[model samples]
Target: MSSSNSVEGSYSKRCAACKHLRRRCAEDCVLAPYFPATHPERFECVHKIFGAGNVARMLKAIPVQERAQAADSLSAEAYWRVQDPVYGSTGIVIQTNQEISSTQCELAKIRAQISMYEAQMATEQQPPPPGLPQQQGSLGSQENMPMFEPNDPFNFLN
Candidate 1:
């Protein structure tokens, strides 16, 4: 007989972070199943802080929970508030191996941008004293200059 509905089948990639925490990684996370088709990235999760920021923000919103399960990620205060005898809060602890989840092209783009900025900064930097006859930066002529002379840098440089 044909057992098509049997448990023998393939599975899709689930949200890694949610899976680690044993949380109900339902249809909420951007990396949920069939993500490549359904949620074609709003933004790459690479070095960009948007995804990390989102998770950090979510952690903040979820208040602390006391007497939490070892696997759950919720705070103690939050756990106590909604703690149930049957349903344990095991899916709270989120785990991840990667720091930056961005693509190669995007990483290159960010690096290039940083390099350009560094170059620009180096070029834009002006010497404290442009090595000209170290006169006071003031436009006042010698006759009009203040009598209280700050030690002239020209004396030392020359």
Candidate 2:
């Protein structure tokens, strides 16, 4: 099991505990039947923990001083932390986020598609969000289209 190639290649296998837990999304991992589809990236499984950056984000959500204090208590305590139910439900896992890595990959693909869509939008003048009626003559129709700011790091085209 301890092979150099294991760390290098696109290994899709996950741990049994994660697989058996049957989670809906990694964010709801605190509860039974966890999944990894909560984040915009949907790469929760790829993270190989819970949600994409959920651990980091959860940790970050707390104040640094509180985290340090909790860390100390955690080390001193012989018992595990109190169990809190995951925000997600068991049905959620069954309905979606079934396969950890595959689901995660699918979620990634969805995000990529969304990003592509957003990028495509960035090329054109802003349009009404989908489902909304387009103005008879919107800015995109104007001839004097302002040049996009390339210097701006968020040019989006980049």
Of the candidates shown, which would achieve the greatest lDDT relative to the real structure? 2
Each model's lDDT: 0.41, 0.44
How many clashing pairs does model 2 include? 11
| TM-score of every candidate relative to the true structure | 0.19, 0.19
lDDT of 2 by residue, 1-158 (tens): 55857643322233222444333223333321222223212232323334334444544576765755443332222121112134324444544665776889999999999999999989786755899876556555555666688798767897
Clashes of each: 19, 11
Q: Evaluate model 1: give its TM-score.
A: 0.19
- Indicate the worst ten consecutive residues by lDDT in candidate 1: 40-49
Cα deviation of 42 in candidate 1 (Å)?
Answer: 33
